[model samples]
Target chain A: MGKNKKENRRNFLSMLGTAALGGAILSPVLSKAANTALSSNVTEIKNFEGRIEDFLGGDYTNIKLRMQDDVRRAMKKPAKERKWAMAIDLRKCVGCNACTVACISENALPPGIVYRPVIKDEIGTYPNVSKRNTPKPCMHCENPPCTDVCPVGATFKREDGIVVVDYEACIGCRYCMTACPYEHRMFDFGEHYSDGLPAVAAYDERPSFEYEKEWTRENKHDSPIGNVRKCTFCAHRLEEGLLPECVTTCIGGANYFGDLNDPDSVIAKVVSKLNVSVLKEEFGTEPKVFYIT
Target chain B: MKKIFYILWAVAFILGIIGVGMRLMYGHEPAAYGSRVVWGLWVAMYIYFIGLSAGAFLLSSLVYVFNIKIFEKVGKLALITALVTLICALLSIWFDLGHMWRAYEVITRPNLPSSMMAWMIWLYSAYFILLIFETLYAFRIDSGKYSGEELNRLKKRLKILASIGIPLAIAFHGGVGALFGVVSANPMWHSALTPIFFLVGAVASGSALFTAIFAFFWKNKDSEYFNQMIQILAKIVLVSVLFDLLLEWAELSIALWMGTPAHTAGYRAMLFGDYWYVFWIFHLLLGVIIPVWLLATKGKKPIAIGWASLLVALTFLGVRLNIVIPGLINPRVPGEALAYIHPRLSFHYFPSLMEWLVALFIFALGIGLFFIGNKIFKLTEDTENKAL
Candidate 1:
């Protein structure tokens, strides 16, 4: 029995040595073959057609790249023909708040004004606990209650379905703020994040490009200082053919944006295919922002 | 007593000037109302003063339109009170605006059809013009400046203006109620009864103010007619107070009965929240109970009725505060308040000192204007006796 075991061990070692040598000899050829196959796969991806859902089904990654292409494609259409929308996948969101910080930095938002806030709720008892993180942005509703309540037609919905406030026209009565069911609108109380400091930081006083206008906080009595502000879906960025700050900065790739008017767009496909819902559907606002639960 | 009152008014006026200076220099920096609780003490004061004006105007219509003989002596006084209080209301709202200079936009580029606010502005503009003309006509006829058909023509014109004013008062005040009611976002304010509730509140508080002023400051206190008028005004105030209480009960009880979190959250915050005493102590105890008891038991005594009406008039601000604040304290999205951390982003709200100072200034200014106008116009002159 001892002799047989020794012979088996020797045979196994010799086989292992032969296999290692053979693998080394064939490594370059195998690598070249793999590279060729990968190139062909890239070509296939580049030439990919059909629904976004189908594309994502094959490869769940590269969603941002796909949505970017969707944006570029939508930009070719006229402003009136394009409808901007956002879809957030709750499953993908880890609640890192990268999007929230990104939005503040992009807009130069003051202390009191927040365009997007991720609401984190912990449900159930300790053993069965689960968490939900919902990022609340302006719904940009089809039937916005805010626009209807502005005493001076200061706020209105654009043809492309973005609700914007004419900061100059806003008398700062904040009626629109109260009128919003989502409470998305915020009144700029002329506050600064660096208030009470010896000198306000340059970043705190930096101008935000909203509605394609440079709004500076140099004067407290200026337009945006007292005006009502909300998420315009980063309208200025859209005008420049770019995605919203939140969409681009979401580390989880949870946020998707595109033209809802285009049936081929990623957002449209996601909305139609997924079990999507809106915040406060009972209000009948018909929100453009959809949440994939 | 008059000396002490003057001293208090002087102090308030001085402090008010300082508050105005701070408001100008710092903008909204000193105000406590943040982005979440957007409207605060100023808004409450605005509605309070405006309700007083609307109520006073409507009551005066009883004299001018219905030609009620007993209230005739107080008609001009009521008009002057309405005008002064209207000015105070406008000032309160004007200070609350983000752009006080751009307020004219509501008139120039108004969204009239969809906006209840625009309708309010337009209606009030008409009411203001009508009020001015009505006051001028009533005073001119009382002055005996013209004789015969001209006098009759003036009286007829005054009657027409007052008649027009009745509907105008109702619409404007009811519009104010609709302003809050139409906000479907706030389950507390969104009610079909809000407009009616506002009208009732306006009448109750306004007549209470008129009662207190007449009881305390009538020119001829010893006149037998003065006692009768005081007793009658006390009865009007007592009924209106009870009615206002009924509406309050309906609003609170209905909301609390269902106990639906969405509908009852605001009421819960109002009745059992940190400032619960505002409803219980300030409004129910002082504004309603004490005033009701005094007006009911001592209805014939001018001094007692005066104190009761004064309590109702002053403490009614507690009612306004209850209405405006609780509607905003409960956020639509749960955990929204916790999601954002900033002083101004907070849901918790209490009016800052600056806000109270500004309000005090407005009140003092209104009183000063009333006295000045009374001196100039002899607002309480027994014009009927002199004319007869």
Candidate 2:
């Protein structure tokens, strides 16, 4: 009885070995089939790179090239000497929300936290109505109200005129939010879009490069999750000699970014226009962002 | 009545534990205050309790600083209440912070020149230290362990502390108002009168709380001094309420009458918006008129005085809510609220259930602390009491 049992066990082991070899041989074939199916869709979108023109199908304006040139010129000077500025032409803004989406993608903003939005206003009656779109980003004011109200000295205005918040130092009092006239600040509530789902997806756990630092939301109770957030003018991208994501993604070619200290820059000429204005001018925030009608 | 009080306390304590647990686990995920209406019930409760602390401390000053003979008996009680309420106030604001763990950064790296909040933190720290020493001295003298020259020396020390505390209370409480007043971004809170108004409101609410505690909790309430004390406190609260009302009217009439959109928008929202009852009913009617009438018609009666004081103290939260919310609801740029659409991105706000539960927990904790202190210290004026 023991000899028969040993012989049956050896036969089962041999069968298992044969099945493992067959499965290994078939796995590559199955993967090849899957790869072919996915490659067709991948080829169609391979060149898109998340640009607005990829979806809108418009001629390339080369605005990104000019902005990149401006960024390169600004990088040569001392950080304090080169003042970063942005200009938005309301006439050219189609309000396609490309800049808003681009900013979210660049910053990897969590749910309910937005750094930029295109405010739409309807003018006149229904029959004669015309809609006006204004894309709003952080004003990066020379005298930012948000910076002055931070109790912990977490948020401060740099000599280069950018308002930056030190996530490590911020106590998340939200006092800065109350003090901001623009209402541009947003608090992170540590929410996940993947909540209540069967499983959390990889995208939900992805890390972002903000302030040129790789930050992963490994836990709910962490910095930037409890901290207030606003636009940093793609400062991380700027450090790498790349234009802001919004400036490149603007489908209407409305947004311009450059060094305000450089007279030859496109943003400098755009900001000099007589029609240029700013939101809540009475606040004396002296916003670095200019809007042209 | 005693059984009912115990039952309520137990319920509140349990619910408070759950609320605190949720806060620890979630971290403001349950709160309704968004970026638009950034300051909500917690902020209101913070100012409300801080105002009570300032008010109670100042009323005690009448006995210690000004040598008012009438308030002498409840001097220790008033100080203890102020200390307890200040703790409650600090906890409320502490929980409201997003990074509560990093709250120490305010003391370590204060931006004094540009931030009124930083100034408030530093001033309150000084006030807190002063309060501890003053409370200790009150107990030390009442111990009756030292007689003659030593007692006189203790009294003199207490007087010096109280004298210093008068300005400290004013500076910190007025600094709280200045914290809001300096925000020129919100026209509703930007007036120069904001700090003065906050000081008066604090006094009114604080004195009312003191009067109620004396009438309801004093073991020897049948004493002749109790009746006179109640009447005096009732009169003081009445005058304070009237002055606060005058300030409210001045602010409302100036903004409403001007009809300028920039200034009037927030005022209009307060008086006529969806939460209009918060101002008209809770604050104006219940907080002001009912108490004023009760205090005026039956000022001599202890029960009437107690009820009026209690009503005023409880409903003053509505007054605080009005001050915080209206200032934040109006957007600086027109149509700013429409720029984004999210649950928390709007200009409208009311506290969530979690907020109320957490507030209730703080209230229960404060009551427990006060009761424990009373048991240990015997805060009554009776000479035969055990020494602290």
DockQ winner: 1
User: Which interface RMSD does candidate 2 score?
Assistant: 0.9
Instruction: In angstroms, give how far residue B268 of model 2 lies from its true place.
Output: 1.6
Output per-candidate TM-scores for chain A, rounded to 2 decimals: 0.80, 0.78
**Fnat of each candidate:** 0.83, 0.81
> How many residue pairs clash (N, CA or C atoms closer than 3 angstroms) in each of the candidate models, in the order given?
0, 0
Writing each residue's lDDT as its tens digit, candidate 1 over B40-92 gives: 99999989998999999999998899988888888889998899889999999
C-alpha displacement of B339 in model 2, angstroms?
1.7
Where does model 1 exceed 4 Å of error?
A1-61, B385-388
On TM-score, the candidate that comes out on top is: 1
Q: After superposition, how far is residue B236 of candidate 1 from its true place, in Å?
A: 0.5
TM-score of each: 0.91, 0.90
Q: Give per-residue CA lDDT, model 1, range A1-293, as digits (tens).
A: 56754454444334433543657566345444533543444343221122245534534457777777778888888878988899988855767788989999999898878899999998877644557789999999999999999999999999888999999999999999899988889888888777789998888878999889899998888889778999999988877778999999986578889999888778887888777899989999999999987
